[model samples]
Target: MRRLLLVSCSVAGLLALLPASGAVAVELPMRKAGLWEMKVLSGGSVPEMTMQQCTDATTDKDMSTAMAPMAKEICSKQDIQKTATGYVTDSVCGISGITVKSRAEITGDFNSAYTVKTSSQSEGGLAGAARDSNSTIEAKWVGACKADQKPGDIIMPGGMKMNVKDMEKMKALIPKK
Candidate 1:
């Protein structure tokens, strides 16, 4: 159950990090090729987690492709606008039984470092309790991937490792439509 929660939390956060081209007017820049370390901090209920991902242009492009259709299917509204400081996004998405309405501010370019501050309200899930959450995710390019790591490889908390390209095999772990 802990691993499932970890995957759920990771996916939710990752959806916000990726560039949502299908719904947004402005195209967010892609991350530079390297290993990126991401820290997720949410106050209150959710726990803080950190993970690292190895990626290149092809991997990033594949992620965008995979996410575009899923977002279009599950998200009812997704709006993004650029500001002098960075980007702001508002989105409403329903995944499985939970409905999430969120707003986020993204700052800094993807080449070096980026931060995403997100506030969201979620309701109508198994817990049956409505909850409000505020989270900040900071990601930075640390350098090249380890010799053993390849593109799409992610090192999760507690040294759990997975590859994004292999997620399809774990579809059962993902929420259903």
Candidate 2:
């Protein structure tokens, strides 16, 4: 009687705690097609570039070409985490075992927006084994068209330039068929 009730109450209390322990939720930001700014922050040989510089250096056509190769390599890495919503990849790029993790949103737009966040370690071994050496990089970008845009329209805080070719290239790399 009393002992049976005590046992049942303990079991119910344990079951109630199970949901709280196993619950997990992740939220991602929303992005739409339009003009956007980019910023690249990196360590090592890769130069830190602004959104304007990337937009200027890449034309819609050129961007399409470069991004194809870049995305293929990035998506195929072993450390990549793929989910129904998006993907994340972590890798070691240099001989020094510098780790770089890039996270890109899986979206419907041909030229999907992305933000890559990278972290690195200086010591020549696995990330955990390494001593006190860590570095980080963040890259952000957006893509879209303007009606007033001509064949070679450039928009920016400065006089930076971007072409349809670059936009096209970026669009092709987005995760849509």
Candidate 3:
């Protein structure tokens, strides 16, 4: 579950970097402020999972950079294209001794709902074993946040709660020197 959350968060952060359109370097269209549910169907070794997140514009923006700390160290060669219904992204990166090639397709009204389909292959890890996987993530606005939920909070399966913003803050606190 923790591994899944990490992958999902990283993917979410990557998706958030999409430009609003071909001519605009803006963020993706904003979704309604409230609870949003995401269902992830992952092929390969990863399990299927579902989770709910609390969000607003600010939180979404903050989460976009949540992976900044690792981005420079691991990611490179990102290519994105905007289409009528959504966008497609392809990237190459190195992580944990493996080189990964990834592609994702996103569609739907980003303001109210969106779905992302991602496929990736990792090479040079796991004792030289290559790994390939695909995941479909569907997210929908589920109205206002619950009383206990707050922006930046995501409730994982089994009721684990994570605040991506808080995690980013903690990452920031680590001194480079």
Question: Across residues 63-102, which tens digit of lDDT does each residue of candidate 3 receive?
Answer: 6556544444456656667777787777666755667787
1-177: candidate 1 lDDT, tens digit per residue: 344344444455666655555543775778999999999887555678899999999998887766766776677877778889988887877877888888888899899999988878877778867767777889999999999999999998899999888754554454766
lDDT of each: 0.77, 0.35, 0.70
Residue-pair clashes per prediction, in order, are 0, 11, 0
In model 3, what lDDT does residue 66 have? 65
Q: What is the TM-score of each candidate against the true structure?
A: 0.86, 0.33, 0.80
**Top TM-score hit:** 1
List pairs with backbone clashes in candidate 3.
Answer: none
Q: What is candidate 2's lDDT per residue for 1-177, written digit by digit as tens?
A: 333222222222111111111134132232333544444434444444443322332344344344434434423332434466544434322222332332232332224444444333323334334422222222234444455554335454356666545544544444431
Q: Which stretches of candidate 2 lie over 4 Å from their true place?
A: 1-31, 41-66, 70-79, 83-86, 92-115, 121-144, 147-157, 164-177
lDDT of 1 at 163: 88
lDDT leader: 1
Q: Which ten residues in a row have the lowest lDDT in candidate 3?
A: 18-27
For candidate 1, what is the lDDT? 0.77
Model 3: residue 129 alpha-carbon error in angstroms: 1.4
Error of 2 at 16 (Å): 40
